[model samples]
Target: MYTVMIVDDEPKLRLGLQTLIPWQELGYEIMGTAANGNEALRVDEEQIPDVILVDIRMPGMDGLQLLQEIRRRGWDTHAIVLSGYADFEYARQALQYGVEGYLLKPVNKEELSALLQKLHQQISADRLEKQVHQDAKSPEWAVYSLLSGSHDLANVSIDNLAKSLGMDWPKYQIVLISFPGLHPEEDERIRSFRERLVTAYAADGQSLVLYFAPYTVLLLANTLVGDFGRADLYRELQMLSGEIRTHMDVAAGETVLALDQITNSFRTARSLLERSFFYDKGRVLTLETPESYRQAPSSSKDTSLLDGEEVSFRLYYLVDVGHAEGIHSLLDEVAAQMAIIGKGETEIRERFFYLANETLRKVSPRLWSESIYPGEPAQFLAGIYSQRFIRDLVGYVTAVMERLARCADYTSRDNEMRRLLDFIERHYYENLRLEMLAGLFNYSSSYLGQLFKSHTGEYFNAYLDRVRIDKAKELLTQGLKVYEVAEKVGYSNVNYFHNKFKKLEGQSPSSYQKKS
Candidate 1:
């Protein structure tokens, strides 16, 4: 309920105004009353009411002075001026003070009720606008949410989202944006700038949603009206980039897209973002068509090197020995062999893209996107374009491999850490406390704690909790009942399980199950 305050020198007038009006029906609570402006200001500071009714003519600080103080303090209270005098000059002064309405002395009940109704309508509209903005950041509402990772809405029904937005499926256009060389702070600034532009454009009936990621922002807008042409959109985007560059030195690129092909547009935008290394800085490159910007083939040979058992064995040998340089060299050799078989750089790139995607599909199917390459897929065959993004990926794979290798090492010194991890993973569903694991492994609990940390880089208890949580996630995803999942994950106490799940997953077990 919204709080309301009354300020009048006359006690009877204040009481009549308070008691005559059905404040509860009008969506307001009479929070406080004051006999002077100073008292009103004090209550306002303490209570911060949503609406304030003040007498215009008063001793010391008058209603107008109180209104000025409120404005100076940036308070959002809606003010209504009340006075015995209905002079035109008084009403004009109230208007100048940002008063929502003016009431003559002995205020009419009908007039007050009408004003309350109007305020209610305005508040409701504001709430609807906010809800709409939030919806735009979810898959059910905006395509931009997909590229920016703002929402894991891959499973959301698009038809439901369209219905909520009052948009036809074919009426939307997706614009994928990329910002290179942006730090977290710079990314925030750029995001704010883009939101402002979207707000301005939306004033003309264009609905827009902005989604931000580490290095990119995506915009999804309903452009079915065709009021704004493609060239106009491009010009506005260029202007926005120029404004951003004035504040921060960075390169921003965008790719406009039709609704049905948003996933492809996102890939095109990402590829363009990466290409900034090869181009001039602070350029707003737009991928109107990906086919037109295809690169020339690499000078690698064409040969089916992977088809030979000897080559396969040698490649695996290099990888097994932790020779990253050797693995890269072997890949280069394979690329060269393929070039010799009359395969252009484009052809080799296409083959490698297919191979890499297929490998990832098997191991991490959840991360795969339907639109792997944008524009014309054939154009992506020029070279393995995603090589630059593989550094972190390779490092991760190497770490996992190193951990597994340590588990397989012949030395007893390192075997304890591996054994602890293996034991935890295998027996997370049992009441396997730290002391139990320590005794089973023939080590003191304190010594085992230090060993686990030195090996896994995490505390023993934390590691165990992580293992249990991961197992719980797997069980929950398989449609286990909440209580059953709790028991299966070794948490016999349902309350404890729910609390732990919430603490780790940021949601309750039931909520996570519903979402999955």
Candidate 2:
């Protein structure tokens, strides 16, 4: 089905479009609606739609401008502009931006239906043309179909596809190789690595590599290959996994099972792969690993600091100000505390729910605009329950906070300051001076300092020092020596680091470490 997104500032118009269109019957799905261009772009990043119905004029970014930005991003999306009688000139400009259709402000059902019908036909024809041009016998495409839930083996001949690849095995296993944080440009390197692995394992070309998510690949390996039995195959796969871990620095998870059981095996392997988030990137696991090791994670961090009134107050204020790093730091502290208390999933979820609700209360208007009100915490709670681990909970809560934070800081000037703050938080350990930032942002150092002071109620140097000190405390807790901590936090002189640490923290680094 073709996915459709509506980008209009009018909530009433958005609701009407969503309800008025016979989307399902027309072979389209209403993916979502966005209030403004900024929100639409963010939503599009998460789920890129095939078509966007946009208003000609909206706050922050107009329809034509949004379409231009989308084109600049090289998104393969069609646009349909919603224009008023007075917006004829704007509509003409939108046509220049590659708008496929146009609708009047008070949209007529008949015209909208016809437009949708034409778009659907075009989309279907495009897909059919691409499919005809493409090679369907490719194993990667077959595996993609299986994983993406687009394949129905009951109707289609999986046997024929397997035979086309010269695979004649009674049993097949799925091997997942994940390169954490690998970008798009690195796919060829991963493909080359996978080819090397396949050559080492399946000399008869029984194994096929499929590109999955970014940073992840799936290998369809025939487990019944060679004169050796399944047991030997398992050992060989394990050794190969070790080589991948050691040489490629890739996390590998494998489940050896029959061809009919590929779906279930893939799921199990994915679950096993989730374990990678806990360990470093290169950790490997197989079906033979302990079940407990493969299960949801538990933390052993201290939770005492989270119990205090000050931490909660800071957390609320941080969320109010769109402080992403501060929220992350607070969540890490909370997670550590939960770990030490040995809280199970239920208690952890409840604690996080409370925290998320408090933050949402402060920024709900920024996220949902005017739709949010009292006695509606349930809507916000929906996104929190699916988390399976402490990291998952932290990630979900942080994403929600960041989304709201962006909205809260949506004004042009506020966004610039927010980006500046983010840069400071990320690079606090570097030699970041006020002059460097001033030059970078094209502002005089004094004016930049004034802006920083006015917004944060602290001098730029002071804020940078605070961030650096906080990082130093964390490193010291990790057992770095005083001199090392000093250098790590951009302090060249150890004595200056000691003085700053004593001034802010009221103790030496060693004393703080020991007390903690």
Candidate 3:
């Protein structure tokens, strides 16, 4: 579907224009609205519309000025002018900019509808003509054939194809540009990529551009191999990628002289692009990268370093203990191990997907909040399957481990309090305070005091006093001296211990010992 943008300074007029026509019914979608020329330009920067409905008079920049700026930037966007007054000069300037329709303000619905219908037909015809007129003799068609390389090419040679396209260059290389992490709309961006490449290179020589699914192929003729011939194109592509805010990777094949090596050039470049996850992004990968990452000898390739299940088990254990540092460390080790595992990319991806699935499954309902961990098993598998590189996938797994670990950390509050209570029970003779335990266990003293009462049904100090006196009673009954039992029960002041014991046990230590 075609996209259109409405640019006008009047919010009321802009709102009126929108309701005045059924945009999608006429084969166009109103992608966005802008109040002024500068805002419209920003919108255009993000996504250039197929058509523009612009008000001729607006603050900051007029409709004619906007059109001129657009054309200056080489965007041949179709324009429909809206003017409150049909001044002769405005009409003349709009005509100069190739305005598709000039409509008076307070537009008639039928008039705007008719104009849009005509514009839609024109755009359709233009697209159809462009596709129909693609010459079979062009180098693009020949590149596609040669790059397709198979036994079916027995009847076809690069010499014959090159002569048809009149290319006598002794050196030819295939450079593949690919965008990873582009989701459902990637096909549209692929088309846009081809258009940009064709426009940027049409004048240099025959534009050798074709789309091979995710990769856009460009055959540079008589160009030096490696970074020498690619510096300019790489800069331009990097800029294009910046516009889309997507990471782009370029792989240039080694220089080849024969027509048949065209397929080899294609294969090498495609392989490099596919293996980009192993290497870094944003840099051009070339001959050496693909070879090194290609498969090692039998001894190396067959050696398995990453036992996927074992890694998952370790991750699960770390999550159970709420060990964020251990999780990150183990994931780093897993990345290193995967590198040495020497498995195929697809196999590695599959193995890691299982590992992630198994690890996430261990995050219990208490630790797994839906808000933080939204991915399901199938989604995790698909995400890992589609991730562009090893680094991004590693990051994804690390985040899962760390975030779930945090969830466990938060949920383990009650458990830490229980451990603290048990510590008090075993060390009643040692001096302790609610504040000291709170600081050691990373809690506030007041909060821990409340938690202690809530868990044990008594205040912290009161509970400690009761435990000491109860122990003193036992020791005194076993024939220990009053002062000795007092000191042993954590009360160094024998008189104070005697008073506390009398208060808790309803008598002095000697009286309790005789009763027992």
Q: In each prediction, how many residue pairs overlap at the backbone (N, C-alpha, C within less than 3 A)? A: 15, 9, 0
Predicted model with the maximum TM-score = 3
TM-score of each: 0.29, 0.35, 0.46
Model 1 RMSD to the real structure? Answer: 23.7
The CA lDDT of each predicted structure is 0.58, 0.67, 0.73
Better of 1 and 2 by lDDT: 2
Per-residue CA lDDT of model 1 for 1-516, tens digit only, reads: 578889888899889988998987766789999888888887636679888899988888888888888889988788888988869898897788788898786788999889976775565445434654677644334654444344445786656655565543444444445444443223456767666665665545445444444333434454422324544555566666654553222222333334435556556556655553332333343444322113323533323454444344333333222233444444445554653454544455554555443333332222222224232323432334543322222333333323323333234444656656665676678666677555445578999888888888999777777788888888999998989988988888999989888998899988898888
Model 1 stretches with alpha carbons more than 4 Å out? 44-46, 130-136, 139-516
**Candidate 1: residue 423 Cα off by (Å):** 99
- Candidate 1, residue 208: how far the Cα is off, in Å: 17
Question: How many clashes in candidate 2?
Answer: 9
- For residues 147-198, could you state the per-residue lDDT of candidate 2 as single tens digits? 6666656765667766766664666666665554333223355556666666
